[model samples]
Target: MTGKKRKRIKIGDVYAIPLPNGKYAFGRIFKDAGIGIYKYIGVSIDDIPRVEEYQFIVGVYEYVLKSGVWTFVKYRPFKSDDEAFPPPSCIVDNISGEFSIYHKGEIRSATKLECEGLEVAAVWADNHIIDRIMGVDKWHKDDEK
Candidate 1:
């Protein structure tokens, strides 16, 4: 055995993310690597935000969680009615900075205007996602130069 204990990461689990300004952001696991970072920024973990609101839903780089960068807060059951966990239908290519729509496993070209509010098709690491969430850096596919 490698002797490293694996933290149980499960669907419906919420995590407390610390921002540089002292406010906390929350992320919920909807599936393996699929997490929704909530739009609600709170003063502390005790301030539970509603699960319905979110800033971005992306496939997070698992290492960030595995390394304990984001602390587990609580678990709320995933619901059939939850709209925050939708698979990314619109995808932006990071290298080429192009946009596409991916739905039902099919991908097709999409205009930049059509990709509004969609994240680049890449797993977000800790710093990148946190900066985006904290408004330290704002990113929109159409704004890419």
Candidate 2:
């Protein structure tokens, strides 16, 4: 509500994530409610850098975006159909310590073994996710919740 309201977020829109250390990070909306966070750690680059400059570190459902925590940088469409992205359908809740698979508009419970070898989904927390990006905090398999 503070800054100018943006229209409904569309996929492929890149955004600037301002970090506290005076550095900046970048993320792109890849799908419904998900953004592929790039690997920038503490880089001081301000504007959205070229894709070759950073790699896709992780894909997450970032709630911060809904809260308007990021500024719209630019729209970068996927190069090809294969470029469309999102993590696995399996989501592991950090607060409830539950795992579920969202498929075909249905949500089903999943066991730890069922989620093995899959890119388990995660919701991006604000600073906590920033810590993860900065290599301070980490998400280990044992840390699954």
Candidate 3:
């Protein structure tokens, strides 16, 4: 019997994977298993409505800065023609030299930690939220502290 050829996938590579519902999702390769088996965390392609080559979205938020403390009130998207602004995907707060991830308007205070860890956690949280909204399984779990 002839063997089927497997596609090569590498870590950090963004790919369009076929979903179970006969639709495709855009996933970023998270792990590379030998023999073409890979573990990926993907968001539905429909989630990213606007695709731009080089675009940065500036968020408009009402914040109060007093006594060196900044409190964010709400987030609003800026009007733009080239890109469609979605709701605030994630909020990275750096207060007192600690980073925290804010999801769905709630501060996950326990996640506050060093910058490196916070960065990873923030991305993970954002991806998790997007996947949830799109009805996809979460690819990563929060590391136990």
Best-matching candidate per TM-score: 1
lDDT of 2 by residue, 42-106 (tens): 35434556653344334555457666777666777887644555545677888997888764346
In Å, residue 86's CA in model 1 sits off its true spot by: 3.0
* lDDT, ranked from best to worst: 1, 2, 3
Per-candidate TM equals 0.73, 0.63, 0.23
Determine which window of 10 residues in candidate 3 has minimal summed lDDT. Answer: 59-68
lDDT of 1 by residue, 1-145 (tens): 1122337876777888888998888888875367888889989866768756888887788788777667887877776634335465577777997889864346899999877766655678889889888776665654786
* lDDT computed for candidate 3: 0.29
What lDDT does model 1 reach?
0.74
Model 2, position 32, has a per-residue lDDT of: 42
> Cα RMSD (Å) between model 3 and the true structure?
17.5
Model 1 regions more than 4 Å off: 1-6, 81-85, 92-99, 103-117, 138-145
